[model samples]
Target: MKNILYTVLLVIGFSAAGTAQEINWVSLEEAVKLQKKNPKKIMMDVYTNWCGPCKMLDRNTFQNKDVAEYVNKHYYAVKFNAEGNEKINFNGREFANKGYNPANANRRNSVHDLAHYFSVRSYPTIVFLGDDSSLLAPVVGYQTPQQLELYLKLFKNNGHTVFKTQQDFQVYAEAFKPEFTN
Candidate 1:
């Protein structure tokens, strides 16, 4: 009976480990430094603490196994709080949320300079950047795993280069068949 219990516990542990989906998230500075060594596209999750859709995105989209695997393989993911008080230095410029009030934590605070630079007006914006730290595009709003797969493949495969016109992008979107389960 002791051996049976031990075996069951071991199986449970392994199952938990297997089910864990981890996205390889790094700081913007770390991503920039690492790009010098091995360049890859950057995917930034710009979210605010007070946003409900942002929380839903974290709980649903980012937690998806297929999304985690694809993002980890192709891009250096960065989670940036638009209302947080962290300073960021990118492209020889400094960025910070000057109006971040600790007294009003988790409420609608001031936006970060970086968020302004990216022209992020929404809470859950996914900013895509080139390997050289240039802005590719900004996808604003909460996206499901399957919904995000379109943009992921579009940028990853450099489809943006050819699909310059709105019509071209529309055609591509129409043809895209998402492979992600969730």
Candidate 2:
């Protein structure tokens, strides 16, 4: 009886401590396959190992329980290293970084061919893709969980399609109420 009480107490203590949850990130090819099976939007974190904002995005936003839980539930999360050497098969084509230097793997190596294919001009770009794997938008730079939730809910609900002009989006942004805790 004492052992059972102690075990229950331990479980309650751990639950109250609130262990961090992580977004289940899959490869680009895996994400594509998953999309065909389950049909969720893809949220690709286009990042480099040397990028500070990329690290901050991982720590500040991605690690947040609310953000991680919502993303894992609504999107097929992908971590794409902009300077990676891995060959990625996407949209019926293969992409690789031909000029990627092994010695500069941690530094600013050549950008992946897929990054150019997506027209990513900045680091830590959160590239959102449709269920059919078409590019929806590239949200560049670090974003707080609250800031990112606006994009998340908008894309998940296809709110971008209703926008006839940039002002429409601006109005939506102005009226947006973020539910995620920062």
Candidate 3:
């Protein structure tokens, strides 16, 4: 019922039509491999299966047409399951969740070593990486399309590199003109 209503609203151009292409989410490893051929920043949606906000991020923010289009064009989107038992090869190192119990897959299993490497302790952290695959920063929690746009564009344009301090970032954020809708 909710999905149908959303589709209806989207078709009616609610927050700019919902008939947009979805983000081309690839695996982190695949993203790295693709980066070798085509240089682009990486936007990793590090989420856990049990997180409510993570699900909302997908349905409410990531589902937005503008977000999907912008991400697909300017970044290699990675939808990583933070607690899943997947082996990850990042920066010449292999990572895995040695403690992950398959039975607790949907109930918050052990954190993947890759999450630990990124210092992600939260459920839905948006980990940004440069074209060289270097960690830029992680924006924690759920963000609306407009809210996430700030970070998306900031990183996409290398705007995050100019901040000398947190206050500097606050000023830039305050002056940011968000172009993404819905």
Candidate 4:
């Protein structure tokens, strides 16, 4: 009976692991270099350490199996700390967290230049860039796996280009049948 119980536990563990999505997160510079080698859209998760919704996004939406797999396969995922002290260079310009205070690393610090450039006003903004490093969109706030799936599919499949108006997107969203299980 003990052996059977152990086998069942092992099976359940493996099954859970299989369903969990493992994301390969990279830095902005690394993602950009990789994009030059092989062109693909970039998905940047701009977040702050003190933001509760940002943490929830990391815990829920980013951990979703289908969302993770799709993002991993199609987009170069980057996790950018909005208040971090990291310097980033792109397109002959340098972006840095100039106002970052070491004393208050956990609390709200200075915003990164990149975040300012993108005009990110929210806690957790999912910024998508085109293959050529063009700004596609900046989606703000905490989005569920099912909610984010629509954007993922829209950008990955060039649905955004096709969606010229608000009505077009509304139609698409209304008709989209999400495959992600929560």
Candidate 5:
């Protein structure tokens, strides 16, 4: 009886894990292209390889099934390495990495100009932008899967323009009830 119970639990766990959706990460250039076509908002995960919390965010928060589904549905998600050499053009300006330290022991890459443009002071900062590439607001520090979901829905549903304060958003969020079938 105990063996059977263990087997059932294992199967259930694996099944839940299998149902978790993968994040469709698009390139900065490709994201821009898609934006022109779809005109959806942008969610950029600004990260660095050497950052521990960034890895945790990718594995824990981003891997959540709801986070993946909601982001894929509502925003063009982009994973950007702050120290990468890739060139990006935004708002008639070209941005590139100017802070790379090739000789550093940890191989820390230099921060890109765009990171500075966004005023990113830490790793794993999630920046949400409007359809026209304007800053909507950035959620700094680490967030759990559930915490991240609230912000994802808030931006996706155009809640920022309506609610002005934390209390207002909390009231609005509490009122929201989504029904998902199948």
Candidate 6:
């Protein structure tokens, strides 16, 4: 009887340990507010549900323990659905679903004005913003967990502003060491 009780307790403990709470995602407004307080940059994952690579990024890259820990530590991470219905206000402008197609099930709501404002041309685009919510350039295409780590560390350490070109970044990337740990 004692052995059975011990086994049950162990199972409960393991289950609790395995279930990690999802990352605490901040809304654009909340992020801006937090930026005023803490002065950290913003990392926005702009994704669409219909995009396979976006799903893969969420599953394989963002969900990785190292990636999550690094992002959570360095930046105010935000998951913004490029096709979602949430209203967003930025820089005295209101962005919403202005071009939604009701007939096409796969057609998502119109790209939010904020997405257009950032000039995002693809799904799963990762936009890194300055502490003042200014554009720091959007990185297109899918990135692996390690690849994203390089960018996170660079931007967090102010390397992006220091390097002038992709070649310069490559030089930095080659010698890059991640300052944040999992």
Q: Which model, 1 or 3, shows the larger TM-score? A: 1
lDDT for 77 (candidate 2): 97
Model 3 ranges with Cα > 4 A deviation = 1-18
lDDT tens string, model 3, 16-74? 55456799999999999999999999999999999999999999999898999899999
- Each prediction's whole-model lDDT (CA): 0.93, 0.95, 0.92, 0.92, 0.83, 0.82
Deviation in Å, model 3, residue 163 alpha carbon: 0.8
Off by over 4 Å in 5: 1-19, 165-182
- After superposition of all CA atoms, the RMSD between model 3 and the true structure is 4.5
User: In model 1, what are the clashing residue pairs, if there are any?
Assistant: none
Candidate 5 structure, TM-score to reference: 0.80
TM-scores of the models, in the given order? 0.91, 0.90, 0.89, 0.90, 0.80, 0.83
Candidate 5 whole-model C-alpha lDDT, 0 to 1: 0.83
Among residues 3 or more apart in sequence or in different chains, the pairs in candidate 4 whose N, CA or C atoms overlap within 3 Å are: none
Candidate 5 residue-wise lDDT, 26-47, digit = tens: 9767877888988988999998
Model 6: residues >4 Å from true position, as ranges? 1-21, 102-109, 177-182
Clashes of each: 0, 0, 0, 0, 2, 0
In Å, residue 141's CA in model 4 sits off its true spot by 1.0
Two-way TM-score contest, 3 vs 4, winner: 4
Comparing 2 with 4 on TM-score, the higher-scoring candidate is 2
Worst 10 residues of 1 by lDDT: 97-106
Better of 4 and 5 by TM-score: 4
lDDT of 3: 0.92
**Which candidate number would show the highest lDDT if scored against the true structure?**
2
Report residue 78 deviation for candidate 3 (angstroms): 0.3
lDDT per residue as tens, model 4, 66-107: 888999999999999999999999778999987789987999
Judged by whole-model lDDT over C-alpha atoms, candidate 1 comes out at 0.93
